[model samples]
Structures are given as structure tokens and as C-alpha cells.
Target: MELMGSMSVVEELREHYVAVVGSEPEYHEMRTRSGESVGVFEWPKGTSRMGVHLYASAGATRHGPGAREHAVELFLGVNTGSDAVKEGFANLILSVLKSNTVPQHGVFVAGNWKVIKGRKFTGWVLTERPDDLIPKLQLADGRHVVFLDALPVFPEEASYRRGNRSDELFEIWEESGLKSWDLDRDLPSVIERRSILRWPSWAQRNG
Candidate 1:
């Protein structure tokens, strides 16, 4: 096994996944419109699939020189390995890298997106990794890469997160007893309709 610091970022991440999940992942290649490509490493976990972006932090814009101490690699969990799901994450990561905004924890990027057909997830929350299975990775250059879970969210859930607190929405998901983050899971918004009434008039009207 290659030691830490000696391995490339992708190699280090692959090793971490192997160590934690005890299996090799299937590599899905995603190409940007500019012809650049990134690998989405996916692993099968029972009825679900977990994917990690291998190049989200390898650049110097978003996670490289611009934000070394706060670098993040995005990951997602879904009910199936849908191409649309992978594309959604890839597009989000690339979009962030190309924009002035840095991906921040507890923030949800809202859009009219359906990661998987027949599902109602309209955006994703950039939250801390669901578990400690994949720990922080330090590169040879001394920059550390943190993993974040790109949890799919409904519009109402996004509103709930914005109006209330991110953790409050997380708590509701925890109480939901459902796979809240799974893109293919047909999960309803856990935020009660009455809760929307407490938000601003704009939010109430929209949500």
C-alpha cells in the first residue's frame, strides 16, 4: 500500500475509500464542456451507491491555492448509480470552481434540478461528510482536503434550511427515518407547511 503524502490526491482518496469500505470503486468518467474530465468514484453499498469526486480539490481555484485550508471534495449517496445523479454533482463542482464563490459548509445551492428522474430534489446541501469513514486527507504540500456530503434536498427543505438553521433541517431528516440524501429516494419535504408561514413573505409565497 502506498503511504500517505507519497500518493497523489486521487490515490490517497481511493485508498481511504478502500480502507473504510473494504472494496474498490467503479470509476465513472465525467467530461466538462471544455473537454476536461473528472473521475467519479462509486461504490455499491447494499441498495445504495456512494460516489466521490476525485478532482474537486485538485485545482488551484476553489480548493487549491485560493482556499487551501478549507478545501473540500464532494461526495453523494443515491439509491442507484444514475448518470443524471453523477452529472449533477460533476456540474455543481465544476460550476463552483469556475465561479468566484467558494463551496461553503451548511449552504445549499438551489436550482431547478432533478438529479434523478421522478424525484423532486431541486438542490444540494454542502454538509459535512455523513460519517468519519473518510477522514481529512493531507497532501505532501501540506494542504488538507476535507470531504463534504452533497445531500440532495427538496425546495421546501432548502427553504427550511435558509429560514431556520441547517442543523434544524438536518434534525428533521434524522427524525424522518428515511434516506433523506439519496437522490433516487422519493422523499417528501419534512418541513411542515405551517413552518413556511413563519418565514419572510417572499419565502412563504415561494415555498
Candidate 2:
């Protein structure tokens, strides 16, 4: 199916995919069937078997020298895909909200999340910072998309406006640096880069 972005899509998916501060940080654990701890954010109702806990956002500011415009970052397992699409993660969340039509991914609206219920919570953070705790996703299509637990999302790179959608949507995760970093070594520098790998977005749609 062709991936498309539209205002209607955003309006349609907002309610279900929104990540509001839960009542309790300690109780907001997303547990698997075997009581395996997942994440701090609450899972969608009836979603017992979670594959991954995705943290995606668009319109976040870019890092390094040329840091004027916003950029997109998709964090799963050990990979960090930058400039995901001009549209960013909103489209993917919207698609996931649709459920049957798109892959099932768990995402939260990007914002400063120091406290869930007026308490300092290090368990779950909103803004990105790689080498932190994150999760993988079990999309609706029964696909397991893996990514790094820690995010490369930086405050300076965080967008003032909540990343919704930009002109570029179909572009998806076409960046080349998905697996170019060595998580075992340095994440920012270039060493013996790992062979390129497919993006979670690619597996979600093209699968």
C-alpha cells in the first residue's frame, strides 16, 4: 500500500496514540504476558503482547554545526535513523493508530517529561538521548522491528513545535547511517561501520 500524509490522518489518529502523563510513574510499567517489564508509558488497551516501545518525533532541531532547521529521528534497539522524513514520526503513529492498515508501533508525543505525576522520573524520559533506556516494537503486521534502547535525541535538537507532518512523508527512513555507528565503541564517530541494514519503517510498510 502507498504511504500518504494528510491533515485528516493526523486528526484521525491523535486520540489513540497520544502519550499523556500517566497517573503514576512506577505503576505505568508495560508488562508482557510473562510479567516482563517493558516501559514506563502505558500500552494501548488490550495490547498485552508488545514487541517494542518506540520513541519517534519529527520537527526536532538538528545537532552539530548546521543546527538551524528541525530533523527527524527514529530510535529502535541499537539504531538511530536521522531525518526520517520531512513528515517525521507523526505519520507513522497515525498509521499505527489506524492499526489494521499500518504496522503496530508504540510512540509518544515529544515533549519535556521530567516528571509523570509531579515527581522526578528517570524511568521514562520524553526527549531523546542515545544510550538510554528504550524498547523494540511488535507492529500490527506481526513484525518485530528492533532499535536501540538509548536515543540520540538531544535538547538542542528538540523541536519547539511538536513534530506533526512536513511536506516529506513517503520518504520514510531512507538515510544511510542506520547502522554506521558502533554502539560498542563511539556512537558519533566513524570507525569500522557495520553493514547497512533495513529501517523499521521499511519493514513496517514494505513487509
Candidate 3:
């Protein structure tokens, strides 16, 4: 979606918050879910570009917290195809929630399949805080869908860690000084330190 459309969604949600809560609630651009920095937005500035992490959170939240209450949860499949579609859908859902008013309480958005012996589903729900709500978004039949009752958690720092393969790649690249200074035998450690700089814009959106 376009930037204007995303801003409109944020504006609509802000209006809904004011209408229901009887006051203008604060709007924050969460940089990292578990970090202390959630960038607050001043209305009229317009919505910032949506990133991949925020997009994923939106999808996870769809089924976890958006669809349920106290014990909100979300489910996802353990495959690549589902992951790609779900990621796109999450972005769409975030766009929708930005414009639409959430129902009084809980809601749900289902997915193609469930993992973890059905203990977790592909979608998410919305509820209270301190509880990591799963928010999810998906696209189906040309329609964008979100599955969370409340806003999805966006973080200010790295939430999920990279895999060993990624680490190895970083180590090799750092030793070559392609992206940073050479630190002798500290190459490995330096690589680990500098790896954080490689996170995509979408991944670091909240910060």
C-alpha cells in the first residue's frame, strides 16, 4: 500500500481510540518489542514506512492477541511458502488495523495450518500487556487480512537472533574488511559486533 494509505490507517485508529477511550491516547512506533524505546508519533507527521519485522509482528498478533483475551496465542506453519504469504498478509493486516476499529474485545484470524501439535495456531489474538501477544497478517484470495485485537508489538532492538549460517557469513565478510575495520584475531568477535549493523531497514524499523 502507499504511504498515505498507511497514515490514514494510523489516523483512523487514533480517532477510534479517542472515541472509545474519550481522550487521545498516545500512539507509539515501537522500535523493539522488548526494549525501552517505543518511538511516540505526533499526529500529522503521517505514518512511517512499514518494515518486515513490524509486518511479521502484525501477522503474529492477528491470531494471538487480536482474536483472543487474557491467554492470547498465535499459530504458524513450519514451511517456506506459508511464511512468505503470511508475511505479506501481515503487512496488509497492519494496514487494515491502522484504518479499522477493533471490535469491543477479542478477535481471530486463521491460517492455512497449525504447528506444535496444535498448541499454537497460525494466527494471533490481542489482549493485555506483559504477555507477548502473537499478531499475524495474511493475504488470501487477493484480500489483506489481520488477526489481532490490539496493536502488534514492534521492538526497538533485535528480537530474534540470526542462525549459525548467518553468523558464519558475517565472520567471513568481516575478516575481509568489506564492511568494517579489521581487528586481527578479534575478527570473529568484531564480526559478531558489526553484524547488528547488517539488519535490514524493515528489521530495525522500530529503532
Report the CA-based lDDT of candidate 3 relative to the real structure: 0.28
TM-score of the candidate numbered 3? 0.22
Which ranges in model 2 have alpha carbons more than 4 Å from their true place?
1-76, 79-108, 114-152, 160-207
- All candidates' lDDT scores? 0.55, 0.25, 0.28
Question: Higher-lDDT candidate among 1 and 2?
Answer: 1
Count of clashing residue pairs in every prediction? 0, 19, 42
- The best candidate in terms of TM-score: 1
Candidates 1 and 3 compared: the better one by TM-score is 1
State TM-scores per candidate.
0.70, 0.20, 0.22
lDDT of 3 at 100: 42
Clashing residue pairs in candidate 1 are none
Tens-place lDDT per residue, model 3, 72-114, is 1122212122233333333334433333444322333223232
Residue-by-residue lDDT tens digits, candidate 1, 152-194: 7766677755564778777777777667545445445645432
Model 1 lDDT, residue 111, Cα: 56
